[model samples]
Target: MSTLHLQQLPLPDAEVYFIPHFIPAPESDVYFGRLVQEVNWQQESIKLFGRQLPMPRLTAWYGDKSYTYSGLENKPQPWLPVLQELREKVEQASGQKYNSVLLNLYRTGQDSMGWHADDELELGQQPSIASLSFGGERRFAFKHRTRKDLKPAPLILSHGSLLLMQGPTQHHWLHHVPKTARAVQPRINLTFRYVRG
Candidate 1:
């Protein structure tokens, strides 16, 4: 286990904590390999503009209850052992208990998430989301919700890193992993959240 260090990122109207190397390299490798094989990764399609289209990345949901987003309802898959283990670590680090997690697998540089906030009604008014990254490094950017003058700040989400977003972060900012042209390896991201019943 590595010494936990929280690095605060300066963003307007948001509270974010970046922890580089949250999991050691050896442990990260094990988790990454197991997750790739154990997780039920699926490329789900969503209804957009009255047309169905595949999501850019593969995703899986695991938790105590179902979650709905982007007009799609995600039935909870029972948590795997490895996921449960990681969840405990994340909860300890962030000091927040999460009952659900949304896992995203970016198979290549072309796979990405669009700009959006995790502000669904099920997440309550303010939610604390703990995102853990493994495998390849990717660019994570944040744009101010109402401020057009503010430039988007890009952060490098390296393997074995953990980012904790809390407070008014989701309410005032939109974040995403943009598509890239450069060659990149697969990456897995797990975002732990506490969904309201």
Candidate 2:
């Protein structure tokens, strides 16, 4: 049985919720671990300033529409059985039909996601993002883009847990996966989105 709740966290004028430990697939975790290994992940490069910096984290995108994306442009891989199954679970929980998902694999403690908001033109206005974490527990941080006075808060993302970013969350805040010094394990995060393209 999966236990989930919508708890509002302390934030500014905006609203945000923390859905701790939502994904209830302990057995499926192992299945996804093997799947992540078998899949062919390409190491892509990103342009920072005038120079190119190769992203440490591996990424893949899967969706219904054929649209170009910014940052690390990854070719959408055919959805595997496990991925498809996960998609259904997320869709039901969010009560929203998502046509696309961006998968990120953090191979080691060195791998990290930089500070960025998911506010994109393709995502339409006020987009809602559902992120599911599996494999390893890591610190996920969020900070207000304009409110520098607000301290950056950390949320421990565990295996089989889901974090949903909705309302004006992406518009007012920016989130990222920070690198840890402790012995870290591999983690796979799936951010489901509804792209109107």
Candidate 3:
């Protein structure tokens, strides 16, 4: 395995690292296929404005502890073999030990995530999150939490790419994957994080 080179993002009050091609093409293809078949994906509903609406994408949670966010409590599923393997690699690359992972599947161009920070109380302060992407390329954007003058920075998260968000990133910024009008294939994202005991 080649050493992953990290590129630091130029942003105030944030510590973010971008590593493109964290996994090789052949391995990434295999991992994507296996995970698609093995993961028990579900469409979850979110409560918005007194209405329950299904999320735009499929999701699964795996870890040793439960997590709660946005009025949803996610019970951890036992780690799958393939997920454990990938987690080990991610830990080695990010130098962070994570006990849980959240997987999101974007099936097409319309599937998206709204701007939000991963600053849940269960994640503790200054959490480190390692996000790995596979299958299709999508735009990942970040905007300052309070500064309206700062322009949102957009990044193309390609297949086999890895992005690490740490330090004060979550406290100062919010990120999201926006929907696009262009045709797109399925994309899978795995975000590894630690849950405070």
Candidate 4:
């Protein structure tokens, strides 16, 4: 078995664990491949202080209903069949029902996400975030807020996998997708969340 295959073997969950080609072989490519073409990706600009700065990456959101977004107002896209199937699978595993998912498409190695917790009001207190990844691999880093010197570890999220961040992860730690020099392919991430009405 390959190293990646070995890593996929059930293990105790780390702060992060590599799912390693977690998607079933038959349907993996089709689901995400279609998603790549279907999502209406947009580069959004955020007002920082007095200046409007374009975010480093492109993003989109999908769900059962309309959602209020910061900087951009979005209307819900009708749920696709593949997404509905995936949602059911994720719900079975995580035991959480997510009404919406926020997608981030990293177009190049230069695109990245900044450090922040997912502690938004819509998520409710201590909400569980079930993040599904596909396409090129990227390094996801997490660091404890109070331990400056602690070595932040990297988790290479592979195609067709899920990572669950639960409990106080949002309250105590910050996570980010750092820029890389590696020649990376496009990646799509679906962070399934339950937004409170």
Candidate 5:
């Protein structure tokens, strides 16, 4: 946390900060390997247009409360030591308490997340989310929900990077990780948040 140089992204109607090297490369490598092996990653299926299809990536949920996302309820799983350690580091940098984390494993460049906002009711109003990225770099972008004049903001989430989105960001903007055809290494992303019981 002491090494973080948090920089606020210059975007209207949102509170977003990015730290490219929240953790050093050596530490990140160790954490990344631990996460890939320790966390119980699962390939889930989503309902789309009345058909059940496998999600593009693997996912895992852990922490204090159950979460419902993408029309599915994810029951909480016991936190692993690695997760707890990472959580503490992230909490220090973000200066916010988080009781839960949602992890995604993009096994290939084709795995991706669609456009969406983290404005769930359980998150309450103006929720703060601390996103931690590991492994391969990926392109991330945000777009205003109803503004035509504003251009979409794009960013590259590098290994060991941290992205914090809070305040009116979820209400005003939607973000996504688009699929790429280019070959790339696997990636893992963790989004830490507090879920009100």
Candidate 6:
């Protein structure tokens, strides 16, 4: 059995849990190296206001289904053995079956993700997302969709950490990784999801 202990984050109207050491340091280092060398990382782009701008980070999609996000339709590549291994661990911990994973490589502190919720219809209602982080620690935050009265919760996503978000979390919250001015090592993040037909 997995020895992972999940700690629930303090936030209303959302179910978020964090595991700071889902993967041990030595194992995380190996996985990080393998992913950076083996995965076909691509510099994807987004069209905003009809202007095509390259995304801040390199990404890859792997699994059994096609998914669309940020106006980009991603045709998934077959899962790598490394990815399949990781997915199994995530599934065992979260008690959710995931057929797809979206990976992001932040080459520097400047590479970031904007505020968005994983509410895509293909993911079905009450989607369970298991996010795994390997490499440098980064700041992650979640803000309420409408309740300005509540403060945004910020967190440090450390290496080998796993974050699980489920239930009504996406329905009421938006999250993002903000760019920082500090110098930091590269970070790889994988969000595992279950896509419905």
Off by over 4 Å in 5: 1-3
Q: What's the lDDT of the predicted structure labeled candidate 4? A: 0.75
lDDT tens per residue, model 1, 47-140? 8899999999999999998999999999999999999999999998988899999999999999999999999999988899999999999999
What digit string (tens of lDDT, one per residue) describes model 6 on residues 1-197?
A: 24578899989999999999999999999999999999999999999899999999999999999999999999999999999999989998988899999999999999999999999999998999999999999999999999999989999999999999998999999999999999999999999999888
Model 2 over residues 55-108: C-alpha lDDT tens digits? 879877777755455555545667767778878887777776788888888999
Worst 10 residues of 4 by lDDT: 6-15
Over 25-107, each residue of candidate 5 has an lDDT whose tens digit, in order, gives 99999999999999999999999999999999999999999999989999999999999999999999988999999999999
lDDT against the true structure, each candidate = 0.95, 0.78, 0.94, 0.75, 0.95, 0.95
Model 6 per-residue lDDT at 110:
94
Off by over 4 Å in 4: 1-18, 65-74
**Model 1: CA > 4 A from native:** 1-3
- Comparing 2 with 4 on TM-score, the higher-scoring candidate is 2
Model 3: number of backbone collisions? 0
Every candidate's CA RMSD? 1.7, 2.4, 1.4, 4.5, 1.1, 1.1
Which has the higher lDDT value, candidate number 3 or candidate number 4?
3
The stretch of ten residues in a row with the least summed lDDT in candidate 1 is 1-10
TM-score, candidate number 2: 0.89
lDDT of 3 at 165: 96
lDDT of 3: 0.94
Worst 10 residues of 6 by lDDT: 1-10
Query: By summed lDDT, which 10 consecutive residues of candidate 5 come out lowest?
Result: 1-10
Q: What TM-score, computed on C-alpha atoms, does each candidate reach?
A: 0.97, 0.89, 0.98, 0.84, 0.98, 0.98
Pairs that collide in candidate 5 are none
